[model samples]
Every structure is written in C-alpha cells, then in structure tokens.
Target: MSQIPKIPRRIVTGIKNGRSVITDDAIATNVSEHFPGLIISDIWATSQMPADLSTEIIVENTAFPVVPANGSYFRYVSIPPDKDLGIKPLEAGQVHPLMHKTATLDYIIILSGEIYMILDEEETLLKAGDIVIQRGTNHAWSNRSDTHCIQLAVLLAAN
Candidate 1:
C-alpha cells in the first residue's frame, strides 16, 4: 500500500474591521478511493450560482461524476503513486487492465516519477514535468516502476 502524503490545511485569510485575520484554517476535503493505489480528493468545488465567500467548504461524497453539472466549478485532484503498478508477470510491456472514462475535461501533470498514460490500445510514457490534457476520454495511469508517481489532475465541467 502507498503511503499518501499529508494534505495541507487550507487557510483562508480575510480583513475584519480594517484588520487582516485568518477566517478559516482547517483541513477541508471529500476524498474517494478507487482500488488499492488509486485515490481522488476533491479539494473544493463550486456551482454555477453566484460566488459565496462566506461558505467555508462544500463536501462531496459522490463517485466521480460522469458529467459535471452545468455551471459547476472545477474539481482538483491529487494522484498518489500506484504502488502496485509494477506487479506484473515476467513479460515485456505488460500493462494492467485499469481503464475507465469520464465526461469532464481533465488536465493532468506529472509531479514526480514516470507513468504510462494508456488510451484505447495506445500508451504514452510520461515522466516528471509532463502534462496530459484529457478531454472526456477513456484512459488509465500506470506507474511501471518501483517508485511512486505523483500527479495533479484538474477536472472541469464539459459542455
């Protein structure tokens, strides 16, 4: 099992009566776990409605939505390394079958280590600093190495 990193506390500062003060400082989120090494954390989300600064946090416990509702704000996700990505038989280029699709557009960035972005029958090897813009498609992430691969994925509502 991969040891997920500690999520930083979100601190919201504000001005009160001409004085700056921290209005909210706490760990806020709604997390979803997929399988053993896969995780999705919803840092914060907003709807199409007008902004509400007074709202501290909006909790979401639903599975990754097939399609984000209209006017919904984007969702940020932190992807930890796949500790079991390298568990394969002694065969070359033997990738696992962990493919799925989503309706929202996703922007994924490789923060550390290398990973394979598999789509349909094709795969692309990506390393640190690499980026992938996933537009409502089927795909999966494979870390074929022993080290963990950290990634940041931002999902936005699709038309």
Candidate 2:
C-alpha cells in the first residue's frame, strides 16, 4: 500500500496576472535532466497543482488525468484504503518480475520505506529519493521493510 505525501499547495500566478505562462516546452529540458537520481524539492508539484491536490498522498479513491499538451501534470489512482497491496516480503535473495507497459514513461520514487525494483530482470534497492526510470520495461516493486512501503509515481506524457 502507498500513502501520498501531504504537500502544501501554492497559488498559481501567471494565469491571472496576464504574465507569461510557464509552458511545457520551457520545462521539457528540465524533465529530461530531472529524473533518475534527481532530488527535487517536495515543493515541486505545489507550484503547479492546487494545495488540495498537491499532496503526494495517493489513494485508490482518487483518479485524476494529466494533460501534457500545454504542460505536464500528475494524476494518481490510489489504492483502496481498506485493502492492502498484499506486498510480499522481499528477501535478500529474491528476484521479482512485474509486467511492462509499452506506452508510458513512469518515474517511481521511494518515500518512507524501501523497496527493490525488478527492472529488466535486474534487482535494485531503492530508498528515499531514489528514482527509477521505466520505459517499455518490465518491473516490479518488492518491499523489504516491515512497514508499508510508500512510493510516489509521476508520469510524463508526450507533448
């Protein structure tokens, strides 16, 4: 199961003041250089999304869409509150596999707990702030910690 981080929301300025809007193109370069070992502030999304939606808290009850045209946005489909992900215990000697998605770019971040990402048949441990870039690759999340492993997921769509 994953718990979304509670991020403070910020008021967007450009759209109201007739100032130049920060378009997606301006940030495309940043995105390419942003993931994979990127350690961005928790305020990252707060600048773009409303305070209510800014939280990293992901629950199955909420499903939002991200429009990548003018820019990029994140949406989450939270896991059901009462149900558990039934995360299997990740042993040191274990190798796990997950299904692959061909059309999307997925960025996974480990939050409060640790997990092993089984990517392309290789196992890697990911702790807080570690990022995994997955593109058309098969992967799985294996939790080794006794506590529930929480993760943040961001999807960047083609503009």
Candidate 3:
C-alpha cells in the first residue's frame, strides 16, 4: 500500500505581549484515513463565532465531531481515484455510497488534481484552483482521474 502524503504545514498567528506573532508553525497531526486511500487532516477548529483570540490556541489531536455545532472546521482531504476504491460512476437514480449531507456551509478549494462534485441529480468536474460553495446538501466527491485529488475545505456551522 502507498503512504498518504502529509498535509501542508500550518502557521497560526496570534497576539503575544500585545503584538501579533507567529504562535504555532507545524504540520497538523490530527489526520485520519477513513478509507483505503482516502485521507483527511483536521487542521484547525473554533468552538464559536468571533473566535476567541485572547488565549494561546492549541489544536488537540482528539477525535472531533465531523460538524461542530455552532462553530467552524478547517481540514484538508486527499481523495483517491474511484477506480482504486472499486467505485463506479453514478448512474441515473443512483446514489454514491459516500453521498451524505451536513448542516454546515462548506467552502472547498481544489488544491491539486481534479475531482467530480456529485450532487443528488447532477455532477460537475472541478480542477485545481476551482472553488465550490457547498451549502448544506447531499453530495459526494468522486475522483475519476488516475491521480489523487487534494482539497482544502472550511466548513461553517449553518442552520
């Protein structure tokens, strides 16, 4: 089996001694492989809006809920090609096994390679540098290309 590449380093900035400074700079350690070739790295999270920047931030590598209630989530995902995972393109009236919905508005950026954003009744191809504003919907990500696709996602809690 091939190893999943590490997500890019994270540089967190904050105020120290009343002056802005780099507080944390390191690779995120809260990573998981939900599937054979699918990897997810939780980079950061906030428990509330107007995030509390008064204290030093510490990212705990604990198992966090996929969608934080009334908060935000930042993560990177590496999706392996569908073929490698024994997944086929969706047919009419069919739903991918990974199809699901969350109550969070997601901002996704295709950082590398390509992927298909599969919705309930339609699918669209997205390449590197493409952005997707996924508003709480039933969807799935399908990598039809021969290479893995990397995406950065910021999810904000929504009603």
When summed lDDT is taken over every stretch of 10 residues in candidate 1, the lowest stretch is 70-79
Evaluate model 1: give its TM-score. Answer: 0.69
What digit string (tens of lDDT, one per residue) describes model 2 on residues 1-159?
Answer: 434333223333334366566322322111211212212222123223234332333222212223333233342211211123444454566544233443446676665666666665577877777877766466665555544445566664532
CA displacement after TM-score superposition, residue 146 of candidate 3 (Å): 0.8
Better of 2 and 3 by lDDT: 3
Query: Using alpha carbons, what is the TM-score of model 2?
Result: 0.45
Show model 2 residue runs off by greater than 4 Å: 1-14, 19-84, 87-98
Question: Which run of 10 residues does model 2 get worst, by summed lDDT?
Answer: 27-36
Predicted candidate 3 versus true structure: per-residue lDDT over 1-159, tens digit per residue: 334566668898988888899988998767777777887787888778877665433444432236557778887888889887788876778789888888889999999899999898888999999999999998888888888899999989999
Report the lDDT tens digits of candidate 1 across residue range 19-105.
Answer: 889987887556665555555556555554454555544646444553346424334344444555334532456545566787777
The lDDT, on a scale of 0 to 1, for candidate 1 is 0.63
Work out the TM-score per prediction: 0.69, 0.45, 0.87
